[model samples]
Target: MFDRFKERTPVRDSLTFLEPNPMRILILLFITIATYAFAKEKMFGNGSLPAFLKHFDTNSDDLIDEEERQAIRDLRAKLREKRRTSIDLDQDGEISENEVSMARAALREQIEQRRLQKFSSIAGEDDLISREEYTTIPGVRNLPDFIFDAVWRRLDTDESGYISPEEFLSRLLKH
Candidate 1:
């Protein structure tokens, strides 16, 4: 090919060997710019893409070369490490959809259990909160043991052997 081209070198060669032919220079410049623009748009548009897939398909073939496949495996390992840190609550260094769901379910169950415990404490021994109970004691009110026994005795109006939770709350709050 070199033998085919004429030896009439231009003064512009001093600037760049490529500048000898303005058309050749323009064509080369165009090719370089087009290649850069295509590479940028096709591959790096979103940083979210897995690195291997971006570089593997220069000709746009779906399958990656062996080298690219190796690269992909390496990249996947690094990404998996990052993902494990992000989602693996147990810190086992592996991430799975089930683990994520399990973590969420555990948190929800904890919240629900706390809610049940809170409600149970509010109800105390009554099991159910009576309407008047909240009004009588807005906050925690200490009841003397003697007073409680006396009140219990009175609440067992029929002289039943024991006072039920309902009877106890009803009698205590009404007064």
Candidate 2:
């Protein structure tokens, strides 16, 4: 009985169940590579430099000359005053810990609301954003294909070729 049981199957045939799915392997590999590319882009890529120059470089020379530097300083001072006024809930010109906490909570709510609005705007009536729709997002159309694709893959966690509002909001909030 033991000999009969052991005699028939080939090793390769028996182990076929253990073979990896090519599609699954490919997806895993893609996710790993895309994650690495996204991280590298965030760390070593232009970051906020372009936006900074665009806002402060009034002359459009791509360089922050002394005048622009002074403008930035003035803007920072104005922003600081604005923030102080907002945070000092009692109008006492000083922000208490309670006021700080309240202001922080309000800011968080505002950010969440803005993100929801963005998701609604992008998703449109279909309530789903395809890769094409994603490219239409502000600043996304200008990205290199590789970087854009990596970001898309990272956001489309379900690999459904579309981004659901949950995915969009969660991914953005995480970062």
Candidate 3:
């Protein structure tokens, strides 16, 4: 219509405003946030057994042998002694994947509680996962917090919240 009217050309949209794709903008924002979070996250807890075998148990092995188990047991003893010394950094005694996870979870809980306690009243998942919760797990009958702590620590090697493939090898093979 403007062309037919012989009017002077108007500026194109880009020439007037810096409008970008809204969806793309949102996706970029989300990716930025996710990358930051991933970076901030403690990169450990590779508890998957398959991944462990992939790295240590050479020859594409699927099972752990006695010798392999002994090596793991030795590693655990070393790490335990190291924890007793200064390597643990946290000084809680004992070193394993789960112990690290629990400590971090506990820290996060404490930080959140401190922030929220000023206004609200509720507990985190850890606080809710009480002694009874541990006992409720099949084969973990009547286990106390100390036992749970030990088990959790052993499973958590890389120190991320969840256990990993290597952690399974370390804990089960060592035992």
Best by lDDT: 2
**lDDT of model 3, residue 81:** 74
Estimate candidate 3's alpha-carbon lDDT, on a 0 to 1 scale.
Answer: 0.55
On residues 1-175, what C-alpha lDDT tens digit does candidate 3 reach at each position? Answer: 5675454347553343345777568768977886666643335634334443345555445557777777767886897576445434556665667666766777767765564442122223433233344345577675676887788666667666554434544465466
The sequence of per-residue lDDT tens digits that candidate 1 reaches over residues 114-156 is 7556546655685644433432444324566676556546766
Off by over 4 Å in 3: 1-49, 87-175
For residues 63-97, could you state the per-residue lDDT of candidate 2 as single tens digits?
78899899977986898799789899899878899
lDDT of 1 at 58: 55
Evaluated against the true structure, the overall lDDT of model 2 is 0.82
> TM-score, each model?
0.26, 0.49, 0.23
> How high is the lDDT of residue 2 in model 3?
61
Worst 10 residues of 1 by lDDT: 131-140
Question: What TM-score does candidate 1 get on C-alpha atoms?
Answer: 0.26
